[model samples]
Target: MLTDLPIRKIIHIDMDAFYASVEQMDNPDLKGKPIAVGGGGKRGVISAASYEARKFGVKSAMSGNLAAKLCPDLIFVKTNFDRYIEISKKIRKIFFDYTDLVEPLSLDEAYLDVTKNKKGNPSASKIAEEIRARILNEIGLTASAGISINKFIAKVASDYNKPNGQKTVNPEEVIAFLEQLDIRKFYGVGKVTAEKMYQKGIFTGLDLKQKSIDYLDKHFGKSGHYYYHVVRGIHNSEVKPNRIRKSLAAERTFSENLSSEVFMLEKLEQIANEVSRRLNKSKVAGKTVTLKIKYSDFTLQTRSKTLPYFISDRNILLETAKDLLFQETLNNSVRLLGISISNLNIELSKKSEQKSVSVQLKFEF
Candidate 1:
């Protein structure tokens, strides 16, 4: 249990509407206006929405048409991933300066272990405040931070005060803070899980705490144990720095559902090229290729193939994607097509080194 273990100071930092905020910051005309950063077409889904647009019920993943209807004056901007990546690198540099124990969740969010930081600062709250301030001054954008004894509480606390704010949860207050929290607000408790908890009469942290671990496991499967520990403030996941990249992918939803084999082939070629670009940008290659297909009716299908050698060339990726697409029969008109490469070579050298070290140790013994 977390109470029995030495507490580690953790902080979860999340940017404020990252992509949309970057658009607003670069274009003064977009500032203080309802804007969405995404494709603006019949089939386009919003990637991010500014707080102003959110006021009128706009949200990420909503259809562009629906978002436009919600806020008639809403403006749409195409995604600029290069700019977002540049800014993300800057933010991550700030995190590394403070602690090497940083785990990035996305381009806009990360968990940091600051139990012992480079600055030798004792207060996590002060560190969070300084980090947030640095982002605003250096990057011209706002961020929110949550400071607590562990990652779970820190992640949740970050949302309590958003858009240039910070919150701290002390060790002594962890239990009380958790008990009063709504089940829906708990990390890993999505809408479906919350409904299941509601059906079982578990509405809050205190209610979840009442269930025996056996009962929870019996009802909720493996996640049951997770809930049991989390309700008691027992999350102990570490913040791992320089985590390996598992895969690189590119996907797109069509403006119109496509059924023609020729059209599907063309789209696959484009998506494979995108995957190749991302792989090259990351300086990685992969041995496994997966193709994802989503039908207009929402049914999904996936096909994958593992190659004998790692590859990153655009032609090879496209050809492999083509083979996978043709191998599967068309079940329905496709609405979305995606290509991804996994089993990346990024960590292969490290694995080889570890194996060599183990062999050396065994020989010495």
Candidate 2:
């Protein structure tokens, strides 16, 4: 379907081990060493791991004890979100120089529609290269990029070469590149979906292409149509700027599980205060409150209530969370507690629709 001569040029930019890399860039001692951020205690979980640590099976979300076991020399550093945010702003400013059509997915990654960039560059790949160069020279950090016909393929290609590298999946090569792609490599297919697809004999993009839209829909539900089109190189999602957060949440994973609801109440208050602080910082308020509960056995549960009006005051958030906590009986000892506010006022603000443009191919990598 992407064969329609005229197509949009998209680029996916991803920073490399951002938090850990920043720590290393600031501290010479951390460079070239196995280091992890935010896993300093006996029960602590890693937020990010340096590439050196990654070689020893260390990774984000892994337990500190396990990481220490994997790499005895692994050093743990506390998270500095303020510093990360400062640096992220600088990176985003760099993006605005090349294009106003930038969509930041997180602090460390973004998508750019450079078909009509401020730089007036015809080759999206060149823009990506120059952007990566600026990030390294100006920010003292390395970044990788994927340039292609759409967000999905570009996102997939971005991972092909990582840590100070770039990949460009030109228009003509989109089909065969996607056909030979591993099902696990599809942008939206997570581990669970990949395994489910694998069980159904959908191992590669080509295999997925073999199934008719009906068969895919019968097996995969709503995502079936999504897969059918993407495998044929047909993702058309546009890069949206000023992306707003749908929900704001604060969660705490305890060093030890609490056996009583009374103990959780105190923790819930702390989480609610954090949620409120974040809400005020973002200048947003929500009408829906949700409480997340994670059991020691790894099972998870959520409870929510919609209010008559939006509220972001710490006391109100605490009260709403307290109500949700008691709405249901506890299933097991709780290891994690989270409070979130949703249906925010900012979501009500509308963004202008992006106009689609099609023209004969006029650029090359």
Q: lDDT (CA) for every model shown?
A: 0.88, 0.90
List model 1 lDDT by residue over 126-176, tens digit each: 999899999999999999999987789999899988878988878777788
Q: Pick the candidate with the highest TM-score.
A: 2
Candidate 1 error regions (>4 Å): 346-365
Q: Can you give the TM-score per candidate against the true fold?
A: 0.89, 0.95
Worst 10 residues of 1 by lDDT: 356-365
Clashes of each: 0, 0
Backbone-clash count (model 2): 0
Task: Give a tens-digit lDDT track for model 2, residues 1-365.
Answer: 66542378899999999999999999999999999999888679999999999999999999899999999999999999999999999999999998889999988999998988898778888999999999999989999999998899999999999988999988778889999999999998999999999999999999999999999899889999999999988876778787778999999999999998899889988999899999999999999999999999999999999999999999999998998888878999998999989999984546455445553444565
Query: In model 2, which regions exceed 4 Å deviation?
Result: 4-6, 347-362
lDDT agreement of model 2 with the native: 0.90
lDDT, candidate 1, at 336: 98
How close to the true structure is residue 346 of candidate 2, measured as C-alpha lDDT?
A: 80
